[model samples]
Target: MGTIEYTGNHHAFRDKLRRYLDEAVAPHGEAWEQAGIVPLSAWKEMGEKGYLCTWVPQAYGGRGLDFLYSVIIMEEMAHIGESGFMVSLHSDVVVPYLFTYGSEEIRNQFLPGCVSGDIVAAVAMTEPDAGSDLASMVSTFREEEDCFVLEGSKTFISNGINCGVVIVAARDSLEEEPYNAISLFVVEAGTPGFEKGGKLQKMGLRSQDTAELFFNNCRIPKANLLGQRGSGFIMLMEKLQQERLVCAVSALAGAETLVEQTTKKARECIYGSGMPLIKAQEVRFALVEMTAHLKMARAFVNDLVNQHAAGANVVVETSMAKFLTTDFLNDFSRRSMDLLGEAALDDDDVFAKALRDGRVMPIFAGTNEIMKEIAARFMGL
Candidate 1:
């Protein structure tokens, strides 16, 4: 809907992915939710199909696709109505750190596996006390003769249980300043002293494998450090724009699916005098209003996607889009539930699931409140 032109290749890719999800992912959505985690096989299949890390260079065994391919994946995954698979988190958010900052040896060791889906990736940044304010993290690392010792725990880490490798952010124990004290390291799952806690029971996004990760004197070779020492904060800041944009894209797509489902319900649900719910003025007005909001959000987010693909600095705009679309998603889901009344009460109701999943959108990828603060600071308000 924005200025980006979709080539025939892009259209073909989207069509193929849509079919694959219907066959491979959509059917397992309920089972994954019940299991509290998407199975490793599902991730491998996604990787095998080249749907994971499409932007990775061909040198790393990726298709070397552009950012638009990523957008297509996010949109289609949202349409399938399963938030737990977290392909975008692995492919776009976490892998970029490894590709951009990891040393050549590190890239060679992990990038192919990541692209092939043999390894799932995660980023460990949030702690029990530190959510959006990363400078407050208490995790510490100290450099030894040839390795670094890490000590601390991270909670609410997505893919904690299933990740083969995690990018751990910890501060230098000897450094006093918070911002400059931080650094990132690639810690494999089975490394001694690195413990992944049990899956967390969450209010929503139940299938997502969120858990606590403990690093008790975890040691890794000096080569595992991503980027320069004490550059974790800078690296994180540089990549946050894309992370938030991914959230915005997913939120908007989820909202679109919800509205489409609810509108269809409205057209079929019988009202007084045996007329459809859409015949009622109240129902019609609600659907109309939701559609109007979605159209506006679509335009805004699509523009941001194009800007992001072109490598423009749209941090302020992306932050705004993230909060706005997620807020609308939650609002629209709630209204759909109300408008549909008893019809939306099933255990597997699409509207109900949307409501539960949408609640967390504003909280993650930096909270909606943090998004506002960022926008205000950048706007000099």
Candidate 2:
């Protein structure tokens, strides 16, 4: 795998974060999973420790750290098998929209809370009928003098229940072109007509709150419009490079964790002949294959991270990494489960959760099929 130079400060931050997760976050993973959501206290604690939104400017209460800090947080969270908290989505994916496109007034109002974890942020783009195809979204917003009134619903929204604020993409009611009609808006959680639906029961990531959001005449000041009117498509596209990169990082990390755990289990399990399972040629070869694939993925993702941090446009590369790494994660987890047989089915076994959760990786952050489509288009196919 390619090496990422870590300064003393970066190493120090990772060490501190690892200790904190071991103490505070790792212990509550199962409880959060049972409750179907992570507690607000956990989010607040991470924020107080400067583990949230490390990239926001110092003026916005963040440490003004670089993208690598965010990468560290994702890796550490994945290592501990904690997916529910979703710090990456808030810190790396959604909050960037607010920081980059929000007006100074808007930034002043929400960015500090985001950095402090007082405000959890979510981006609502997918509706019932629209997932990868943003242009087909049915949500609509109309200008009404001083306010924009939004009327529609969004489903499969991550952080839906916990979010204090959301960046919503809705179409202008009068615009005819789907591509040009959509605009982004910053809507606080308790807006009059905005309501968060109950958390949906899912096969995986049970602790992460996913729900439907309804906007029935939901009104926000015109000032809440993010960037140019009718520019939501462009804005969403612009930020996807980073979003896909984050997905790739998380997938690769999760794959590595799964392999490490499975290898340890293989070393401990005894065969019918009284030898360790790892002694079996097939098991050894499987472990070796998984490790080799992970090494290649780690190198690719790390290089993309370096390019992204350097301000290079790596949208196509990131999209490829997103699908490739996530596909590997799913395959690795499934193979681990098969190799472990009945032991992997235990209620407390981490492999079950890993397997289930890994299934969604290729589906979200734009499906693997969509990722290939994007890469193909960029490659002049």
Q: Which tens-of-lDDT digit does each residue in 23-47 have in candidate 1?
A: 9999999999999999999999999
Candidate 2 lDDT at 375 equals 93
- Tell me the tens digit of each residue's lDDT in model 2 across 1-381: 267888999999999999999999999999999999998888888899999999999998889999899999999999999887799999999999999999999999999999998999999999999999998999999998889999999999999999999999999889999999999999998899999999999999989999999999898999999999999999999999999899999999999999999999998998789998889888889999999999988889999988999999988999999999999999999999889887789856899989877788998878999999999998999
Error (Å) of candidate 1 at residue 308 is 1.1
Candidate number of the best lDDT: 1
Q: Estimate each model's TM-score.
A: 0.99, 0.99
lDDT of each: 0.94, 0.93
Cα displacement (Å) at residue 159, model 1: 0.7
Q: Residue 256's C-alpha lDDT in candidate 1?
A: 93
